[model samples]
Target: MFYFSICFMFFIILFLMSFFLFILSIIFLMMDMVYFFEWELVSLNSSSIVMTFLFDWISLLFMSFVLLISSVVIYYSKEYMSEDFNINRFIMLVLMFVFSMMLLIISPNLISILLGWDGLGLVSYCLVIYFQNVKSYNAGMLTALSNRIGDIALLLAIAWMLNYGSWNYIFYLEISKNHMEMMIIGGLVMLAAMTKSAQIPFSAWLPAAMAAPTPVSALVHSSTLVTAGVYLLIRFNFLLVDSILGKILLLISGLTMFMAGLGANYEFDLKKIIALSTLSQLGLMMSILSMGFLKLALFHLLTHALFKALLFMCAGSIIHNMKNNQDIRLMGNLVTQMPLTSSCFNLANLALCGMPFLAGFYSKDLILEIVMLSYMNLFSFFLYFFSTGLTVCYSFRLIYYTLSGNYMGSSFHLMSDESWVMLSGKFVLLFMSIIGGSLLSWMIFPISTMICLPFYLKMLTLMVCIVGGVMGYTISLVSLMYFNKTLNLYKMSFFLGLMWFMPLISTVGILNPFLFLGNFVFKSFDQGWSEYFGGQVLYKNLKFNSLMMQMFQFNNLKIYLMSLVLWLIILISLLMI
Candidate 1:
């Protein structure tokens, strides 16, 4: 126990160190931005590799959110992680994940960005499997493999770009601006980005990933992994602006938005529902960014990091209090008991549902504004239209399931609200949910008014908000009524889960046939070996004859020796060649 305490303390110390490093990185980013904005290329040597400037307006905004979300997640994990569940390993992986995400955000070069990208995915896999249990291990493995497929595409893009002596992000930016290589490497990279972001047909692993602990889910879905895809898109937005493939990306993002949003509406698992919700929101952000509404997408990303992390952690707390019962149906009237958690989750839900004056409202409204202005694109129209309704449905469902149902849990003891360490983090996010938008709305939506939105536009947004809320409320009432009498609506809403399984279905033949053939071949070989060696007859004879047994044993030794000699010869020849 004392040794475990020492290990745990070591993790705490590491977490603090990471926190300090993050602060320092943010300061450096500010300095980097100033240099990038004002400095000329002629002023510096070409080959120098010192602390370099990487900031653009997008990177600067992304860095701020990355730092802020990572800090909050670390703080929340300090108390939420179970001491017995390899807490030290969890903290180390968390710190590594944060550091990698920071590197990704400010990465000046594609090579550097890929480094961070691959590293973040790898560390997240570790976090997912921190429990060292079978289910977690399998989930982590699957998630890692899927992300690795995306990683390979990124590597291919880097290789293609480097073939032209372009190793930096500026190559792609220049290509976008100049219309160079519009269809090849650019398209490949976009597909890679989609896979990483959990876009349609590739989103199955994300829900499965909820087998991880809630903190890990929060980290994965909130800012690090899912956002990596969106960041890649934004980073290459210049190249994507007028490209045909880029237009297709807009369509794909829109489809993913509706599919994942609706998928979340009927999930009973707390973490899976949130995971799908994150994917859906990411799709919205991606769709906006794909249409060149960069700042609006980023603003949504920032607000999302704040509230989504809060939701996941509070869900973690609720799960902890229930001794890991993650079924939302089993959790009821928990808000009155877990006030701190309830407050944070409710605040996040408000933001998610785009309720009035919440951070989600301002950020999400910005995206809607962009979509409205560009309503000429039929894809955009359907994307935003379906997304608005689906977002409200799932957002309300997530809130209603966990805290609004009649109490149905077994006799469960309630601990105090959450630990001070955890509550401190939750309060920060809750505060952000309430005030972060209005305070930074101008900075967040730089294309709009710096201080306040135009009067007419604000009024337009207010009308949308009020109408959307009423529609959401009505849908929830109808859902409740239907659920009380039947389960059709619930089952219909969840049909998208079938789409999520497409990948596994496509690969089933490849895997199943080979496995079946291998099993048959191996069984055949075993029977052939046994029969030819007369193993059963030999065993019966050996039981009655000692001489026969000695002869058979000698023959076995001779066969083994010959096999070893043959293997050595083959190995030697291979080595020589």
Candidate 2:
């Protein structure tokens, strides 16, 4: 009961704070006003401890977006979770999640960031497991363990910073530029960011995290948990660009982008499709951030937040109307029933595919053009464009499955766009999805970027997107008659569909060997050799010795003779010594 009121309180406070922060962010942008707060905690000997908060245009703008999205997400969750008995607890968890994100958003010190970092991981685990199912439990563990790696990395970075006698990483960009310790710290931070953002070798948890409620998915995937890594890297971009770690991140992020898009095409779950799309966009942000486009990365990050949130909210609406059925195979002609949601979904999908003048287009198109103009190797160039096509491929494939077919859901389903609370949450982001990109592009870049490329090169994005759309339409046209042929190619399809077995490689693939080793150790040491030779062996020897002594004390002739002989032998041995 109180949770609902508190949620409303948070929504109002965050919305108001977001408004003022955006204005202040613009002021900081225009007037170059950077504010830092350092509170002295204590003085010990010659050193002092302080709590630091940094307020600059970058942190402020990010905070504004985080708060704004969180407000809408909380609003959306009201209708979505209303039926659940644990709705109050859900609201509380969501509030904690939002608070942790704000803490992470404004901190310049690694020590303070770790508090928020660990909070995000812990709160997200709670939210992921809120369903009280085995699947949710496993997903929660995976999410927690995967994020723990980044938390440890941040801890190491903080420990490593001790050499410099300060935790304020903002102040060391120039001093630690070329130092060896800084290189190690940079690598650790990159590893942290990669794990948090679900980059290659650590991406299995993102889609699996779809076990969470749809509203949590919208919040976590869009603007909170997944983006934390990208934001961390954005803060450390100066150390990443042109470094070895940056080059590696560029390649890995490109691969992650490709893999996510490919996996989404083969996915059947509606929510997971969106999850993979989020992963792909995260890869985009990370790739460009590695390429030294921090502003472009932030621009896309903000714009992506708007549409992706809207996308997931629409997804939540459809999922609810379908009676919690998330399989797209059961969802068709949804556009005819839930017109508003379908429209929002289609708009978000188009924005994701980088439709011209939409949110994704402004950032995605610019990123592609910049990649085209940058002198890069052929491999990186192919990855950039091909991944873009894959994004559209999945987007169109999803569109065809969900919106274009005859009604395939249950006949009893009362599918409609009647949830005003949910719709209200969506419309704000929907408006932003259309207008936020252009506005951000204007505000983020006071001076527009200048680029010139050949016409064919400039049109490459449209060309690939067209090809992908056609492919998607054709792929979705595969009727039941063609199901047998896919089985023939099941091996290849399974590999591609399952993220190239990275999930296997990340999950059971990693745990099995360690589990086997642990079993072996338990058997041989705790129950086998050590069991036989340890305490039992010592007790057995002592018992046998005591029994032999008892035998000698028996007062029989043979026993006395044996004891006398043994005693004579011992005395002679002592005399010789």
Candidate 3:
């Protein structure tokens, strides 16, 4: 009861704070007001260390959304973590995560951003390993180390920024595009963002992080861990949009989107599928931002946060009711038992597919339309539309597996919709998922986006969604006959299902050489040359000298008399000379 009260208190406080922040953000947006507060900690010759806070609409709105999601996730945790012995610890970790996210959101200074960035990496590692199993430990290490790459990148960026004599990166955005040092700083920042966002090469950690508890999954996937990179890039768009690095980011992020979408279609794990979808969306945000649609990327980022958080919460409810089994193949016709959760789940799934006027439609459709309008290569165009179709295919496949067919799990488990506390936590996000897009569209950019395109081009998004849905439903209906037919394609399926061997490359393939080299170093240096020359050999020399000295110390009058005669002869020879 005491722990429950603490959870409730946090939820209430965050809810109130978010509410206030939202209102303030709206006012700030309407008035075009940006307030900057600076506290100088040190003022040295030609260098000042200061803590700076930027209260523009972007930071305020983002902070509000993050706090809102964190509060709800905390509320949901009360029910989900009710049986855990250390619920308070979980709450504290979550609170720490929120604080770090807020810090990242508000800072315009590179040094301060690194502070928050490091905070995020540290706290998320704690959350990932909260379960304390081998899988969790591996996942936590992967997540931490992957983010550490970005942390190092940010550190390098900060160090590079020192050449500018101040760490406030905002003042240098326009200047960054022209200078070589500024360009390097931008690249470093982009590298950090890519790692944090789990873009290619670093993609292994996002799904592996599913080893964490569902509540942490909700928080991490939604607003904190993965999005941190996108948010940072959003801040650094000025430096990237006009540079070659921007084009490279677009290509990489587009590939990431396509890879994630294809992998999700092949995935069986429920949490992993959702995590992949988040990855794909992140790619969309990055790709779009690289194409110079900053507002669209930010729009998608905010909307994605709402729906993804809701989706994870719904997944948690289902997982809890189904005895924590996350295999989608083992779940079917869950709507019959868990109506509310199923409704929210289905809502999120459709939103992800960009169906009609749901939260995702406004932003996702606009993004696709803008991509169509952009002058880009056919390869990039194919990646955009094909990835969209793949998203719907996987979403529908998930729906058919979990919500359409007869119940597939054991008959003994009683999946119920009685997790009211969890449901209550979900309601805010559910409502937001329905209207958050339009609401943000109205609030952020009052001036509407204008588009003039051919009818066929305009309808491409809907066409892809429809076809993808059909493919999803059709292919998911696998009978024994279907199984036999696909048996010949086992190798292909395995390749696609393995995320094109990305996880293998990231883990075993990348680490094997380093590990082998470490072993060689251990043998050749620490244990071989080092052990002999500086260790064993030196010890043997010291021991031999000590033994010789001890022998001289023994009672031996003959040896002492010989030594005295030699010394006296030396003295007489010196006097005669």
Backbone clash total for model 1 is 1
Steric clash pairs (candidate 2): none
- Model 2 lDDT, residue 307, Cα: 95
How many residue pairs clash in model 2? 0
Per-candidate Cα lDDT values, in order, are 0.72, 0.90, 0.90
Model 3 per-residue lDDT tens digits across residues 104-133? 899998878888899999998998899899
Model 3, position 242: C-alpha lDDT score: 66
lDDT of 1 by residue, 404-491 (tens): 7676788756645847777777787788788877755755433554335467755665565466556655665566667665465445
Q: TM-score winner among the candidates?
A: 3
lDDT of 2 by residue, 9-66 (tens): 7778888999899999999999998999998899899788888999999999988988
Candidate 2 versus the native: TM-score? Answer: 0.89
lDDT of 2 at 129: 95
Ranking by TM-score: 3, 2, 1
**For model 2, what is the alpha-carbon lDDT of residue 253?**
98
Give the worst 10-residue stretch by lDDT in candidate 3.
478-487
Using all chains and alpha carbons, the TM-scores for the candidates as numbered come to 0.78, 0.89, 0.92
- Name the runs in model 3 displaced over 4 angstroms: 42-48, 478-481, 519-577
Which structure is stronger by TM-score: 1 or 3? 3
Residue 46 error, candidate 3, Å: 9.0
